[model samples]
Target: MSRTVFCRKYQEELEGLERAPYPGPIGENIYETISKKAWQDWLSHQTMLINEKHLNMMDASSREYLKQEMQKFFAGEDYDKAEGYVPPVEKE
Candidate 1:
């Protein structure tokens, strides 16, 4: 996908999140930090939406296509030496 389209789609989700309300400090912190449990909760909610609205909403194919594109993007670089390829766990 073109960067413009990708940004447009991503901007919408981010804007939605910006407008969403958090009920408590912990929930607000999770939304900002994306902690493991928060990630899992987000994953579960997304999964439910995917299963129930495969045809009703969301571009399901976009996920698979983006995955392949991202893989292709990183295939040429060495994991240990690649520029801007920091492993999350290894980051300090």
Candidate 2:
């Protein structure tokens, strides 16, 4: 059986990640509190932010910006969005 966590993002008990996403305390914390679904959602959003904002991961500032955004995102607070971006419509 899979582990379940009281997901901070969803505020409900849900299936948890199999392991920490990366090394360090933050990863551990996420493994304990963040649901897999929430993590995946963040990844998609992160990619959109990177592409729309033209962020270079090699740049320290860009990485820091994403870090801050990640915190806000999980906290359910106001986070940066890709400006002037529109979602593509799906065909029936």
Candidate 3:
């Protein structure tokens, strides 16, 4: 899918699903929801790749980025805030 189309579709879906992370008041911020939905889509693509290639391999950086992105999302952090947030490096 083209980047532009994917972003538009993902944003529309996120707006339809998901509730506010906090109970006080819901604002215009849609970062967490959008990030989660986008991540899920991306993961699905990766799953397809794994099934097609018969190899359980994914890039370390990409995995790390996803982890951190989810964490920030749950924390109610927007993409701008989460941009600098990186997950701890895993030692094998």
Clashes of each: 0, 0, 0
lDDT of each: 0.36, 0.93, 0.43
| Per-residue alpha-carbon lDDT of candidate 2 for residues 1-92, written as tens digits (9 for 90 to 100) | 99999999999999999999968998999999999999998998999999999999999999999989988898899999988899778899
- Name the better of 1 and 2 by lDDT: 2
Model 3: clashing residue pairs? none
lDDT of 1 by residue, 1-92 (tens): 21111122122222123321346874454344333333444444445434544423356685554334333322332212223433346566
For model 2, the superposed segments whose C-alpha errors exceed 4 Å read none
Instruction: Give lDDT tens digits, candidate 3, residues 40-68.
Output: 65455445434543443377765555455
Q: Pick the candidate with the highest TM-score.
A: 2
Question: How should the candidates be ordered by lDDT, best one leading?
Answer: 2, 3, 1
Candidate 1 segments whose C-alpha is farther than 4 A from its true place: 1-32, 55-92
